[model samples]
Target: MSAFEFVFTFYSLMLGLAAANVGTGFADMWRDRRAIQVGVCAPLLAAIVLVATMNLWLRFWRSWEGVEVGPWALITLVAYALPLVFLSRAMFPGAGSTTSLEDHFFQHRRVMLAALAATPGFSLIWYAAQGTLMPDWPNAWLAIRFFAPLALMALTGRTANRLGLALILVWMLVGLFR
Candidate 1:
């Protein structure tokens, strides 16, 4: 496989790992009783995001490896990418119990579902920034990935999120150096 294939494969795994972390973060928050809503919602959302991201990523990676995007691959690719676009913003931090109730969606459900759906849009940003070229794409994409740091801080709490962001940046730097 080419370096692009290898690097993107690693990046895809990284995204999966990040998604898992998101689930764990929410689970932890829920366990701590800090955000019951996040705890209840985050794990499920994370799984969807992870599955979808992985599916889309595999298709792209296969194509990068010079494989054709066949029917199955195309199906998975679409299944993953489009949902991720809006799902990114789901379960945002600002919504407390007073802000949204489960039944609220029937009347203005889309409006009520805002917080739980923000993350997917950001996921789209991350994916798009990854680009379609080689060598230059992923590396260049890291620069744009910077936008995620603040959101991470907010979602995970400033101190812990900062550390996590720093760690991810460090990992990205190592990949660049490699």
Candidate 2:
């Protein structure tokens, strides 16, 4: 196998597991809908995680396909993938519990947001290590556009978190067209 393929095989599996985790979480909520209060926040978070995992998979192919894979690349890739898995797992309560999805979301919000916010920085570092070319923007507005609202949401109330998530979804949608 080519070097990228060799490394990507493992990465693909991780992403698949992340996606599956999100799907299963959603399914569990559906199956228990009669007993469970399926709330907005957790489902929204699941959507973000699922879409982000798919984006990461596409990014791996687009950015890393021709790049040389080494020990550090493997290490960084693992670091990147684990938080995604954690975020996926956090999207729902454990196998059996009576907590509502909203309660589960608030209970895990800090860790969930932390994991969500971390990936962009890790992506930057991974690309830097690989000498991948990044876009040069005017005044670093792009970075601020993401990190600022997330930081606000992480430190503020529920309203801010909802707003931040809306912003993130908008950004993701905008990114798709770019």
Candidate 3:
């Protein structure tokens, strides 16, 4: 098999497990729905993680197409997927526990956001290692597109509800335009 194929197989497995974790978490929450108090933030964050996982999976094909893969590439790929796994695991409450979604979200938001923030950095590293074609995009644009929402969420704390919604809206708008 080709290097890209072999390497991507490994990456895809990790991504698939991450996706499954999120899906299973949702199922578990539904199973325990009557025992838990549902809230806005945790569900929103779950949606975000689910979508981001899918995006990374889909984007991988286009982004890594025809790329050379080596040991360091494999290492970086594994590193990149680790955060997604962690974030997925964090999306739902633990077993046999009753808690409000908001409480769970607040408890884990920092780690979740940190995991979200790491994806772009890993993508950049992979691109740089492969010397792929992203030089035309400015650093400022990258930072604004990727980091702004995360930073706002990190800094604003509990007061970021409306702001988070606004940011999601803005991100959707940006995606539409792009």
Q: Please say which candidate is ahead in lDDT: 2 or 3.
A: 2
Model 3 error, position 132 (Å): 7.2
How high is the CA lDDT of each candidate model? Answer: 0.43, 0.74, 0.68
Off by over 4 Å in 1: 1-3, 6-21, 34-42, 67-90, 94-178
lDDT of 1: 0.43
Candidate 1 lDDT tens digits, 11-77: 4654555465556545554554543433223343444445445544644565575544356444443
What is the TM-score ranking, best to worst?
Answer: 2, 3, 1
Q: Write the per-residue lDDT of candidate 2 for residues 31-77, one digit (tens) a residue.
A: 99999899777777888777777767776788664657788778877
Q: Under the 3 Å rule for N, CA and C atoms, how many clashes does model 3 have? A: 0
**lDDT for each residue of candidate 3 in 8-67, tens digit (9 for 90 to 100):** 799889988888887888788777878897677766666666666666666566656655
lDDT leaderboard ranking: 2, 3, 1
Better of 1 and 3 by lDDT: 3
Q: What ranges in model 3 sit over 4 Å off?
A: 125-142, 153-159, 162-166, 169-178
RMSD to the hidden true structure, all candidates: 14.7, 2.9, 3.3
